[model samples]
Target: MPALDDLSLLIEAARRSGEIATSFTGKTAQRWDKPDDAGPVTEADLAVNAMLHQTLTAARPDYGWLSEESDDGTRRLGQRDLFIVDPIDGTRSFIEGSDTWSHSLAIARDGRITAAVVFLPMLDRLYAAAAGAGATLNGQSISVSDIATLPEATVLATKPVMEMQHWTKGDPGFKRAHRPSLAYRLGLVGQGRFDGMVTLRKSWEWDIAAGALIVTEAGGQCTDRTGQPLRFNNPDPRLNGVVAGGDAVHAALLSGLAQTQATP
Candidate 1:
């Protein structure tokens, strides 16, 4: 099972993981929130996380593992390559019978993601990408839209992000939309279903690692809200936020973010 050369094993593992996740979808499973306020987790999450650990780690024994469902082991910081995963990206949406959740997976080497996969079981859409290999949705090549600039761009964001002030140009208006799953939002952007996506709140690496690469591989730009490049597998494994999509829209979002942050 040493298929970790590129995204081969990761993609394979993701498909299998998707099966595990789907088995629990719409089921009456155990659930609760974390004391750390890390949000909700269900028995499905634990089961899927265990399956991924068994399947992926057995294939890449040396690869470090960083998963939202797994405890952070400081020893992983010593590994050169790491697996970052979110067994179920939209737990809330999934529990509510929504179709936005997905199994998210990615590999990071030296803090840079090189391979990624996002599998939406209910939608039967699989988004995959590798460094220099480009991005694909359901085996079809994908790329971001050419649309640039806000107000005209169609974006996926929360209400707060929409209400925020824009730059000197004015309220960075855009056709605002919302999605519960951060990973799915990025996947949509990568698939050109949206012109771009943004969030002004802290996000987990497991939530964006795979999506970030998929967007970039699809010819989109991705970075923190501050416009800094995203790097994964850090000890904290949490970034401030994400602003990703087509080139012009990405720049516009970052510009607006800078202005809003500068507000008193």
Candidate 2:
């Protein structure tokens, strides 16, 4: 099937996942931390994950599955095509009644994401992209900002990423901000709402897979902290870190990060 066809499949699945998630809103949904301090999960996340797994795998049985809420096994490693999914990208935000949580989904073929969707249902913001087909927000085309320098950039990141330890020559002086959902942060960058986003901590494939494609299709760059291209569905299912932005700003961020390592 074509990438766009797969993108359509993901779009519908994400919207339906949104519907399932909202049903848990305004009510107390069971929430608990995962093993090894992996963060929280709620009843809504499981519900949405079950629906997406059943529906999507039914439509494409030949494909493999890798979902945040599902058990990780080597079965997916044997397949050429895989579904990478995050039922809810911001469970803490959802538990706190924030409307910014999102459903992140992607189709990866041979370690490359071919179709991707990051849907913020509460905000009614749907970001979709097919490899080489560009990106969209609610069916309208979207792209990253033209800002070429970090000092003039606005970035989405946690406060710790802005500390002096992360930069060699001191702060880069870009406006820094935070968003609970890593997927949403990437989508906002693709939509030109922010010039870039960075996270130096190891990241999960489900959290960054869809947004990585969205940023790339939107004429931006999405890579690890070392400026290496992102490849999904690895045996480990994790990345060194993430740094995404328009080309120039991406380069600047990587350069500074490399300097930090060389310092002290």
RMSD of each: 2.6, 2.2
The 0-to-1 C-alpha lDDT of every candidate, in the order given, reads 0.85, 0.92
Which sections of candidate 1 miss by over 4 Å?
A: 1-4, 25-27, 165-170, 259-264
Deviation in Å, model 2, residue 107 alpha carbon: 0.5
lDDT, residue 107, model 1: 89
How does candidate 2 score on lDDT? 0.92
Question: Which run of 10 residues does model 1 get worst, by summed lDDT?
Answer: 255-264
lDDT (C-alpha) at residue 141 in model 1: 99
TM-score of candidate 2 on Cα atoms, chains taken together: 0.96
Clash count per candidate: 1, 0
Q: In model 2, which runs have C-alpha deviations exceeding 4 angstroms?
A: 259-264
Candidate 2, 70-147: lDDT as tens digits: 999999999999999999998999999999899999999999999999999899999999998999999999999999
- Candidate 1 differs from the real structure by a C-alpha RMSD in angstroms, to one decimal, of 2.6
